[model samples]
Target: MSSIEGRHPDRNLINMPMKQNLVKEKHDASLHLISRDFETCIDVCQKALHVLSSTVDLQQASDHQEEMEEFIVIIVQAYAELDRWQEVLPCITQHYSGIENVSPNVLKVCLLLHAKVQEFSTCSALYNIWTSSREGREVNDSDLEMLLDIYVTQTLLQAGKSSQITEVVQSSQLSQDTKERLIATYSELVRETQLAEETASTTALPDLAHPQNIVDRVVAKGLRALRMMLMWIWSVRPRLSTRTLYSLGGLATLLIIATQGFDTSNRTLEILGNLMEHFIRSKR
Candidate 1:
């Protein structure tokens, strides 16, 4: 063993210079990307990846795998920035066979590229495969969030099936709190969509005599007022003394009492009032 060591030294020591060169090359490629020199970045990354792929030593190759991944990611990004999905798709498919084989960074960029090209079916398929592969497997919070945001929320939303978001979250292995938060976000989105639709309807029909249109306008105005009141409460909260805040709270309660038994034609106002009451009660 001593004789072998004396004759060959350490393989890692011999490969050290090559590794340093590869690292420096990767750094240069990253800098090129930051500088938006996509062409040069692609050239540098591809060359480094090729060199890393050619390494014959198992240990050396393993050591270089991470650097190689970085190279691939850089190349993919450069191609994407250049709007060369024609090349980027092939590059990614050549290296990674499936979602499980891909690094999160590569997956994110490639998914976005697919979506950019209106490849909704491909994105949906990839997401399904990922969910299947990850089933019964434990994932960190960040990864869970990323997958839900990219595949379920943004992708499906763009595909015009965003209503499926809650269903998907319900089926996911996410924690209870995360699922609730995602559902809340989806509800907010639904509310915003309703508001937009209401505005569009009101604009389309200038008839003030229509009862439905009148109700919509009132609901919209009430929503706006509720939002403004909430904002004002939050803004004045810090400046007011506890006694002043209690007085404000008392006045708000009196207002709520005054609103009770008011005409039920505007159900939205009642809902908003209930929400305000619940919020105040929770704060207290």
Candidate 2:
């Protein structure tokens, strides 16, 4: 082809940008986000989105996937800062599909923004994906805290759902570490509740934990949590044969100590005694 757009047309067309011009063009909007100039960044990001949509077809989304995801991240973050929460999910969802792998930062942006607005449905979907997918599963501990805050605080999980928690522990794609943490948190909450009930007349329990802060002595979650703790302990007990119980003897011993660490009421003392007896029997 004559008069072609050949490689040597402009002296072997240099890809190396000479000035800071190219760097500025690529990162100026990102710098806006760093400075918390979200409004300016939002404009730049939206323009980038428009250009991407106009230039690429659905079939070519993979071609621009990395750059497009970066644009989506900036857009969502800007929206989050603006408190335009309702718009953030759709913005991420449109570009995010099954095959596309998003960065952890993008998952975080989606999860937190959705949680902030109490968008439980969307948050659940995002969380299920985050928990299940290997692509974005290695979450930071702080990010895990943020996720639990949304689950325990915002999402309305009925406290006594042993079946539900069991299902999650067994079937979930969450790592063993996450499952163990969840159970540990639940147990610690139970321990705290017992301690709080023992001293509640002098001190106040927090509202989110239960209604002991106010006139009511108990609420739905509190009762459910209390009952569920007992049920879980019992449910685990039946599986203990001589060998099994002996295997768990150390933990049983620990449990007796842990149970005693709370209130020392007659009922609690009875439990502690029973646990002590059980641990002794298991030793033989």
Best by TM-score: 1
Q: What lDDT is reached at residue 277 by model 2? A: 60
Quantify all predictions' global Cα lDDT against the true fold.
Answer: 0.68, 0.55
Candidate 1 lDDT, tens digit per residue, 1-284? 44534554443332668778987998999999999999999889778766655554433333555675678778877887888877875665554544566655666776777888778888877667766777787766687678777876557777878778888888777889989998898778867777887999888876676775565565556555765675577676744444554565455445444444344345555665665565565466
Scored by lDDT, the top model is: 1
lDDT of 2 by residue, 1-284 (tens): 22322423433211234123323533877899889999898778766655554443332333354556677777787788888877776665555544124555677667666766767677667766666665344556665555554554444342332234445444544568877877777666656665776898545646546433331222223333444553455467754455544444445334434544343345434543554465455444
Which stretches of candidate 2 lie above 4 Å from their native place? 1-26, 34-37, 50-70, 97-101, 129-166, 174-178, 189-284
Q: TM-score for each prediction?
A: 0.57, 0.44
The alpha-carbon RMSD values of the candidates against the true structure, listed in the order shown, are 16.4, 21.2
Number of backbone clashes in candidate 2: 0
